[model samples]
Target: MAQMARSPRQLGTLIQNARLNRDLTQQALASMVGTGQKTVSRIEAGHPGTKLDTLFGILAALDLDLQLGPRNKGEPDLTEIF
Candidate 1:
Protein backbone atom coordinates (compact mmCIF):
# COMPACT_ATOMS: atom_id res chain seq x y z
CA MET A 1 0.00 0.00 0.00
CA ALA A 2 1.16 3.49 -0.78
CA GLN A 3 1.18 5.91 2.16
CA MET A 4 1.14 9.67 1.76
CA ALA A 5 3.13 11.65 4.27
CA ARG A 6 2.87 15.41 4.10
CA SER A 7 4.40 16.04 7.49
CA PRO A 8 7.41 14.87 9.44
CA ARG A 9 5.23 13.10 11.99
CA GLN A 10 3.38 11.20 9.32
CA LEU A 11 6.66 10.26 7.68
CA GLY A 12 7.98 9.05 11.02
CA THR A 13 4.90 6.92 11.51
CA LEU A 14 5.46 5.33 8.12
CA ILE A 15 9.07 4.60 8.96
CA GLN A 16 8.12 3.18 12.34
CA ASN A 17 5.49 0.95 10.82
CA ALA A 18 7.91 -0.31 8.20
CA ARG A 19 10.50 -1.09 10.84
CA LEU A 20 7.99 -2.91 13.01
CA ASN A 21 6.68 -4.91 10.08
CA ARG A 22 10.23 -6.05 9.35
CA ASP A 23 10.62 -7.22 12.97
CA LEU A 24 13.63 -4.99 13.40
CA THR A 25 14.45 -3.28 16.67
CA GLN A 26 15.46 0.39 16.65
CA GLN A 27 18.96 -0.63 17.63
CA ALA A 28 19.07 -3.23 14.89
CA LEU A 29 17.85 -0.77 12.30
CA ALA A 30 20.33 1.81 13.52
CA SER A 31 23.10 -0.72 13.25
CA MET A 32 22.11 -1.34 9.66
CA VAL A 33 22.23 2.42 9.00
CA GLY A 34 25.37 2.99 11.01
CA THR A 35 23.55 5.29 13.42
CA GLY A 36 22.75 5.15 17.11
CA GLN A 37 19.51 3.87 18.62
CA LYS A 38 18.77 7.39 19.84
CA THR A 39 18.94 8.61 16.29
CA VAL A 40 16.41 6.01 15.24
CA SER A 41 14.22 6.96 18.16
CA ARG A 42 14.39 10.62 17.23
CA ILE A 43 13.56 9.82 13.64
CA GLU A 44 10.62 7.72 14.73
CA ALA A 45 9.53 10.60 16.92
CA GLY A 46 9.54 12.98 13.97
CA HIS A 47 12.37 15.22 15.02
CA PRO A 48 12.71 18.04 12.47
CA GLY A 49 16.48 18.27 12.88
CA THR A 50 17.01 14.92 11.18
CA LYS A 51 19.32 15.11 8.17
CA LEU A 52 18.24 14.08 4.69
CA ASP A 53 21.18 11.73 4.37
CA THR A 54 20.20 10.00 7.63
CA LEU A 55 16.58 9.79 6.54
CA PHE A 56 17.58 8.31 3.20
CA GLY A 57 19.90 5.89 4.98
CA ILE A 58 17.05 4.69 7.18
CA LEU A 59 14.72 4.34 4.21
CA ALA A 60 17.37 2.35 2.35
CA ALA A 61 17.98 0.14 5.36
CA LEU A 62 14.26 -0.67 5.56
CA ASP A 63 13.98 -1.30 1.83
CA LEU A 64 11.63 1.65 1.51
CA ASP A 65 11.78 4.08 -1.35
CA LEU A 66 10.96 7.78 -1.18
CA GLN A 67 8.86 9.00 -4.07
CA LEU A 68 8.34 12.62 -5.02
CA GLY A 69 5.38 13.98 -6.92
CA PRO A 70 3.22 17.01 -7.27
CA ARG A 71 0.76 17.40 -4.40
CA ASN A 72 -2.83 16.50 -5.19
CA LYS A 73 -5.09 19.54 -5.05
CA GLY A 74 -8.38 17.70 -5.08
CA GLU A 75 -8.00 16.52 -1.54
CA PRO A 76 -7.25 19.00 1.21
CA ASP A 77 -4.11 18.32 3.21
CA LEU A 78 -4.09 18.08 7.00
CA THR A 79 -2.17 21.32 7.34
CA GLU A 80 -4.74 23.19 5.32
CA ILE A 81 -7.60 21.81 7.39
CA PHE A 82 -5.88 22.72 10.61
Candidate 2:
Protein backbone atom coordinates (compact mmCIF):
# COMPACT_ATOMS: atom_id res chain seq x y z
CA MET A 1 0.00 0.00 0.00
CA ALA A 2 1.18 3.50 -0.73
CA GLN A 3 2.31 5.31 2.37
CA MET A 4 -0.02 8.08 3.45
CA ALA A 5 -0.11 10.26 6.50
CA ARG A 6 -2.93 9.22 8.84
CA SER A 7 -4.00 9.95 12.38
CA PRO A 8 -4.32 7.26 15.01
CA ARG A 9 -8.07 7.04 14.43
CA GLN A 10 -7.51 6.57 10.73
CA LEU A 11 -4.99 3.88 11.42
CA GLY A 12 -7.48 2.17 13.64
CA THR A 13 -10.09 2.33 10.91
CA LEU A 14 -7.70 0.72 8.48
CA ILE A 15 -7.02 -2.04 10.95
CA GLN A 16 -10.72 -2.58 11.55
CA ASN A 17 -11.35 -2.87 7.86
CA ALA A 18 -8.58 -5.38 7.47
CA ARG A 19 -9.97 -7.46 10.29
CA LEU A 20 -13.43 -7.46 8.79
CA ASN A 21 -12.08 -8.35 5.41
CA ARG A 22 -10.37 -11.31 6.99
CA ASP A 23 -13.70 -12.34 8.53
CA LEU A 24 -12.48 -12.07 12.07
CA THR A 25 -14.53 -10.77 14.96
CA GLN A 26 -13.12 -8.40 17.53
CA GLN A 27 -13.16 -11.13 20.13
CA ALA A 28 -11.54 -13.61 17.78
CA LEU A 29 -8.86 -11.13 16.85
CA ALA A 30 -8.25 -10.25 20.47
CA SER A 31 -7.79 -13.91 21.29
CA MET A 32 -5.38 -14.33 18.40
CA VAL A 33 -3.40 -11.29 19.53
CA GLY A 34 -3.45 -12.20 23.21
CA THR A 35 -5.57 -9.20 24.24
CA GLY A 36 -9.09 -8.65 25.51
CA GLN A 37 -12.16 -7.83 23.46
CA LYS A 38 -12.52 -4.53 25.30
CA THR A 39 -8.99 -3.60 24.40
CA VAL A 40 -9.69 -4.28 20.73
CA SER A 41 -12.89 -2.28 20.93
CA ARG A 42 -11.08 0.63 22.50
CA ILE A 43 -8.52 0.53 19.75
CA GLU A 44 -11.21 0.40 17.08
CA ALA A 45 -12.77 3.41 18.78
CA GLY A 46 -9.47 5.22 18.49
CA HIS A 47 -8.84 5.55 22.18
CA PRO A 48 -5.87 7.81 22.75
CA GLY A 49 -2.70 6.76 24.59
CA THR A 50 -2.91 3.13 23.51
CA LYS A 51 0.38 1.38 24.21
CA LEU A 52 2.79 0.96 21.30
CA ASP A 53 3.12 -2.75 21.96
CA THR A 54 -0.63 -3.14 21.79
CA LEU A 55 -0.69 -1.40 18.44
CA PHE A 56 2.09 -3.66 17.22
CA GLY A 57 0.16 -6.70 18.32
CA ILE A 58 -2.93 -5.55 16.45
CA LEU A 59 -0.90 -4.93 13.33
CA ALA A 60 0.66 -8.34 13.58
CA ALA A 61 -2.73 -9.95 13.95
CA LEU A 62 -3.88 -8.17 10.82
CA ASP A 63 -0.82 -9.34 8.91
CA LEU A 64 0.34 -5.75 8.64
CA ASP A 65 3.56 -4.03 9.52
CA LEU A 66 4.37 -0.47 10.49
CA GLN A 67 7.05 1.47 8.69
CA LEU A 68 8.32 4.82 9.94
CA GLY A 69 9.45 7.27 7.32
CA PRO A 70 10.35 10.92 7.02
CA ARG A 71 7.40 13.24 7.59
CA ASN A 72 8.90 16.27 5.85
CA LYS A 73 11.12 17.03 2.92
CA GLY A 74 14.12 17.97 5.03
CA GLU A 75 13.83 15.04 7.41
CA PRO A 76 16.80 12.71 7.49
CA ASP A 77 16.54 9.28 5.86
CA LEU A 78 17.35 6.99 8.74
CA THR A 79 16.97 3.79 6.73
CA GLU A 80 20.23 2.42 5.40
CA ILE A 81 21.02 3.38 1.82
CA PHE A 82 20.87 0.43 -0.54
Q: lDDT tens digits, residues 1-82, model 1?
A: 7788877878999999999999999999999999999999998988889989999999999998999989887978776854
Put down candidate 2 lDDT per residue, 1-82, tens digits, no spaces: 7544246566778888889999999999999989899988888877788888988999898898888865776644435221
Backbone clash tally for model 1? 0
Q: Candidate 2 at residue 43, lDDT?
A: 87
What lDDT is reached at residue 2 by model 2? 51
The candidate that wins on TM-score is 1
Candidate 1: Cα lDDT at 81: 51
Residue 63's lDDT within candidate 1 is 90
Off by over 4 Å in 1: 77-82
